[model samples]
Target: MGQQTVNEPPVVEGPATQEFAPEVEKLINTVAKFTVLVSQKLPDDVAARLKELAEEETAPMAKMIYSTMARNQDLAWQLKRPSCQDTGLVQLFVRAGTDFPYLDRVDAAMKEAVARATKWSPLRLNTVETFDEYNTGTNTGSRSPWIYWQTIPDSDSLELDVYLAGGGCSLPGQGKTLMPGEGYEAAVKFVLDVMTSYGINACPPLLVGVGIGSSIDAAAYMSKAALMRPVGSHSANPKAAELETELKDAIDRIGLGPQGLGGQHSVMGVNIENSARHPSVLSVAVNTGCWSHRRGTIRIASDLSYELLTHKGVEL
Candidate 1:
């Protein structure tokens, strides 16, 4: 992130003024465009890491697969098209400041952004209402494009983490509540069990996010949140960070490799995110991000200036 910051315009508490409505709409349109762009373009950090992995791989078949992946990334950027057919289920985590002027308009702006991206990004129709079972085509049905929000104590900017959770990865998300006596050791066992059983079903070189919290839902949310972290980033807690390294090494030994064809490594990395847990309940959850890991961060200034934090050469 750049230290150079812009002073946002004055904040209007109650609602965005009529004069600002069009400006707000402009912000929505810009978000819509970037939403589409992100699906088409892999983030810079991920691309760089993949390249490094490719160069390090020793097996000829594995190296060739990695080269093909690089070509796919290049072609996607060149043609401005999605690299994967599963454009995925969109999940947005937003950190909005309390002092921000357009709080009331955020939901509408984001919803419009998703809708517009469906057409312009040509996102696959991944949403369908339960029971009724028909694609909305618009990608806006019953919280189809899920948005998780957090309001900051005192800030005016809006920060977002966008995730494309494809069916392969989403289908394998695992959660369990372990008894206190089961301990963190059991939690690690559960993750290992899940990966051994189903990790390869999702793409390999997976980014494994382990969540430990008081309840299953809390653990699950933290697990997904962990996927937002950069590939090589580890938890601040020394114990957690150490466990991340251990687990990554252990899992990569399974040799699922890139796209599960067999290679030197099974995972890109492991990340653990935790919260204060109940003495009686130790809930653990695991969320696996695909090898083509589609995740990005963006910041929107109060004055509507934008920054694509996870990608380069993006304009808004």
Candidate 2:
């Protein structure tokens, strides 16, 4: 899948596409292409981890499911289509250098890129307005193609972390707050409970992201953000890293297996991201990425030259 290539350049041709300057237009084209790539191809890390998990399975049923997954990816690459039917609602986590020239245009360009990708990659129309109850049909609506922004000091590049949050994976997402006295064990229990009750629905062998903070909102954001990290990555803090390993072991012991059919392992890995909480309260949230966790990262220089960090050897 990594070696698969699309030679034809993606062209964005709406009334809005011509509004951008040459530089911003190039940015839009590059981002649009990368968005398509992210939907169709698993990142190198995810692909490698899937192979590792498949090797560890001893059950014939689990083994067969893994083989099916491998074939699914091959077909996705060969057909030049999304690996999963739910291409998911696009989410971009942007780290823009303070000096980056196109920062002002980044937001609009990102929306344009997603709109273009919807037609080109043929992404499913996943954006629906609340209460209004209608699909936007462009994979975009009010505040759709969600963007989370950060500022980078003394740099001249924009780094984009792309994620496809599908409905099945999003269904299990939850958050909770515990009094100081509850301690961290309660947080651990919260994670285990969520997994055992809802994990299978997301298709087992999940990539779990846990976030600890003082409020549900903060923890929820961090939890989803944690999914942007590569599978098998550990937190920099030693204790947090230990928690990752512990939770991974505990969840694997659940034996949900591939596609939740029951087998040797329940998760690809567990990742924890935390922020110092208020002394009075502790909040923890959980987010899961299904076996086909579609995510990627790209770095674009001020000149618009780019690097596909997560998908090495693949070009936009």
Candidate 3:
């Protein structure tokens, strides 16, 4: 990210602004623009990884598909439209500092931002009520634009990992509890089984996220969070990093290639995030991001200055 300072004057001019209404409006606009940006352009790491995969692909048909994907992205940028028709269900992974002045307002601001983005980006209406089963049309519904939060201690910044969880990629996500006796090897097996069975449906080369933890819910959350990491990054834990490499190599060997038609690679990379679990319990979850990997990270400082950590040389 370029870390450029926003030069626009504050949306409101006043000294008695304790409510921070001006800041909220600015945040809403910034997030709305970011939503659109990610829809049209892949993150820097994802874009680079795709190019690498395209070069490594040797199958004639797969290579052609890769070229088509490249052209699709180019057209998306040129036309300033969504690269994929399913712009996806909006999700924000929030890491908000406890000291952040606007903590209480973040939720409303983000929801409003999504509403604005829906119209501005012309985002596909993907939110539907569960069970009741009706599309909201506005891309907002009960519990839609799901926001996952983590509070930071003794800090004053807000960071967000925004993701467009498309239906294809969402279809392959799975989590299950394994007996401790089955061991980590079983976890590996679970990942392989899921990908081998459903990877094609996700539109490879995928960015596979694996989470191991004490409970299914924890594992599922971590699995999705892992997708927010840069494409080729590895876990800090040596064992986890090794698992990542092993899984990545195994998935690549599957030969799903571009659009899963068949070729040399099935995934951009594998990321493993783990949490210590009760001795009796082992839970593992797998989540995948399709090749487009529509996601971005932004860090906003106390004064509301921001950095787009994933898309360098870009501004909202």
TM-score of each: 0.92, 0.94, 0.92
Give lDDT tens digits, candidate 1, residues 121-162. 788988776766667666766775799999997899889887
- What ranking of all candidate models by lDDT puts the best one first? 2, 3, 1
The alpha-carbon lDDT assigned to residue 58 of candidate 3 equals: 85
Per-residue alpha-carbon lDDT of candidate 2 for residues 24-142, written as tens digits (9 for 90 to 100): 88999999999999899999999999999999889999999999999999899889999999898999999999999998999989998998999999898887777666676678767
Superposed model 3: Cα runs more than 4 Å off: 1-20
Among residues 3 or more apart in sequence or in different chains, the pairs in candidate 1 whose N, CA or C atoms overlap within 3 Å are: none
What is the lDDT, from 0 to 100, of the residue 106 in candidate 1?
86
Worst 10 residues of 2 by lDDT: 6-15
The candidate maximizing lDDT is 2
- Model 3: how far residue 35 lies from native, Å: 0.7
RMSD after CA superposition, every candidate: 9.9, 7.5, 9.2
Show the colliding residue pairs in model 3.
Answer: none
Mark the 10 consecutive residues where model 3 has the least summed lDDT. 9-18
Candidate 1: stretches off by over 4 Å: 1-20
User: Per-residue lDDT for 1-316 in model 3, tens only?
Assistant: 8885534332432222234378788887888899999999999999999999889878999999999999999999999999999999999999999999889999877877787889888899897777666566667667668999999999999999889999999999999999769998899999999999999999898999999999999999999999999999999999899989999999888888889899999999999899999999999999999999999999988888899999999988
Candidate 2 TM-score over all chains jointly:
0.94
The residue-level lDDT of candidate 3 at 162 comes to 88
